[model samples]
Target: MSAPFVKEIPTLLSLIQCADSLVKNPLTKESPFSVRVAWFDDAAKTQTALLTHYPRLVKESFYTEFEDTVQAGISLLNFQPFWSIMLGVETSQSSAAAESSATMPDSSPIVIPSVAGKDSPPEKSAIR
Candidate 1:
């Protein structure tokens, strides 16, 4: 008799743990603003399916709390539950300047909207 196939999906907590490390560690020491993530799923078909569709589930599970934190202007890194699974990361002014110049052409300055006000001057901020 042939053995039945089995698949395993990592729990949300496991994914969160993995994500935590990615966020904590910068892609390069010189570029503390950048993070590297490998978007690969488990080898198992069923597990891969779950990971492929996990973004929605993650949002559904944490959207409310995420919204609250944003409204309060609190850093997601400080939020224990969502720290590892944060959609994005914050950047410092110096890091932003360095990254922008490195990635963009010098023809024109890139205009980024300010959170304080639409008319306010552009400033470095988190990329979420």
Candidate 2:
């Protein structure tokens, strides 16, 4: 028998794109947040890099309150304004297929992250 062939999952870049879209523009009424995932052979290094790269975010109330950083990351991604800079894009969209299947969705999920220097209350306050 011949060796089986398997297709590769989309690249991190593609994943980021997908995440950016969902974060940028939510579709369903209940599910609004987006997600980003990173894979690595070395889990420790990946965790280190994430913490090091976003120390402020990691230190903020939102991150501190959450038990899992992965969930924190997902929450952060939902923060509307900040998500834009992470991807350097105007707006984003979630995958239609994924949105349809989701359950236990977030109510009033973040649509636009608060912009810096704006009158909006800081996101940090939301956590408290």
Q: Estimated TM-score per prediction?
A: 0.26, 0.21
* Per-residue C-alpha lDDT of model 1 across residues 30-117, encoded as one tens digit per residue: 3322221221111122123333435454344343333343323223223334433333222233234445555644444334333367
Q: Could you tell me which residue pairs clash in candidate 2?
A: 21-92, 21-93, 22-93, 80-112, 80-113, 81-113
Clashes of each: 0, 6
RMSD of 1: 20.7
The 10-residue segment of model 2 with minimum total lDDT is 1-10
Model 2 earns a TM-score of 0.21
> How does residue 5 of candidate 2 score in lDDT?
10
lDDT of 1: 0.34
Q: Write the per-residue lDDT of candidate 2 for residues 6-82, one digit (tens) a residue.
A: 01122333333443343344233254333122211122232333343334445544344332443344464464344
